[model samples]
Target chain A: MKVQVLYFAWLRERIGQGREVVETEAATVADLVAELRAREERYDLAFSDMGAIRCAVDQALAPVETPLDGVREVAFFPPMTGG
Target chain B: MSEADFDLGAEAARLEAGEETGAVVTFTGRVRGGGGLRRMVIEHYPGMTERALTEIAGEAARRWPLSGTMIYHRHGSLAPGDRIMMVATASRHREAAFAAASFLMDYLKSRAPFWKKEETDDGADWVAARDADEAALERWNE
Candidate 1:
């Protein structure tokens, strides 16, 4: 499956881009993260601590265990600080 | 999304409030000055941001008897004293309007996909999400 991965805020800064289209066979959000982390040093650094990052699948908040089989978009970023 | 200051008074006047509407509640969030802070920049998830906000507004309406609801939030660079966001809720009674506005705010503070970075005289840094804000969201679920 392919997922449109997005990064926001500091995550975007660290990853050096806002979004990317990834060709992956990962099944879950955590698995997808591992694949991204393995791809480059920046991704590994941005995703070093899953506890500090939040994920959303198809614009809805999702946990690391969330399945990505049918999902088209996934976003990663720090916890929201908006008001 | 607006870089210019919003006319909140004008906004409230344009809000929907028919003869049945007995109350209209509004809340405004502003950036605080001092601490040598120069300005702040907000970033959002674009398409997902609007979707999340609409979902939250729907949740607020479902939770309370609201006649109308409005949420306006700004992105991009903002100086101190700038208005960060606003929420307005109209209902037949005061409690519903107040509660709906509060509910929308709570979600905005946490669930919204917006991030703020503060630039001060020393340098700049990303504003971290507070544990207190996350804790605040729990009250609604409880």
Candidate 2:
């Protein structure tokens, strides 16, 4: 399976890229994060603390345990400071 | 164009256009000039932003007796004193209009997909989400 993963704010800066397509069998968002961390040191550093991150799957706010079975995109960022 | 572009009077006029509108509630968020702040940059999830805002606004209307609701948020680089965003709610009574407007602002502040970064005299830094903003949503229980 392939998934499009996105990063925002400092997460985008730390990971050095905004988005990418990855081939994986990951079932949940947590699993996807682990896969990215295993790919490079920068990923490990950016995802060093899971507590510091929030995620949205398919553009909807979702938890780390959310299944990505039919999801097309997953985004990771820090807590929103909007409005 | 910058802060001078938007006209609050025009927006209020539009919001008050409804025939049965008896109360028009509006709130404007502005950039503070103190703390040596120079400018603020806002970034958002492009595809999800409009959807989130619409959902939020829709929910506000459903919860109150509002005749109309308006939200306008500016993106990209903004200097101090620039208007960050505005929310207006119209209803037959002042209570519903005020409550709905407040609810929209609270949700927009914490739930919206936008992120703000501040550029100060010292350096540029991202603004962290405030605990108060989260606490503000507790009353809604939505």
Q: What is the C-alpha RMSD of each candidate to the true structure, in Å?
A: 1.2, 1.9
Best by the DockQ measure: 1
**Which residue runs of candidate 2 sit more than 4 Å off their true CA positions?**
B1-5
| Model 1 lDDT tens row, B1-142 | 4556777887776665488888888999998899999999999988888999999999998889888888889999999999998888899999999888888888898899999999999999999988888888888998
DockQ of each: 0.87, 0.83
Candidate 2, B48-121: lDDT as tens digits: 87888999999998899888998888888899998988889999999999999899999998788888899999
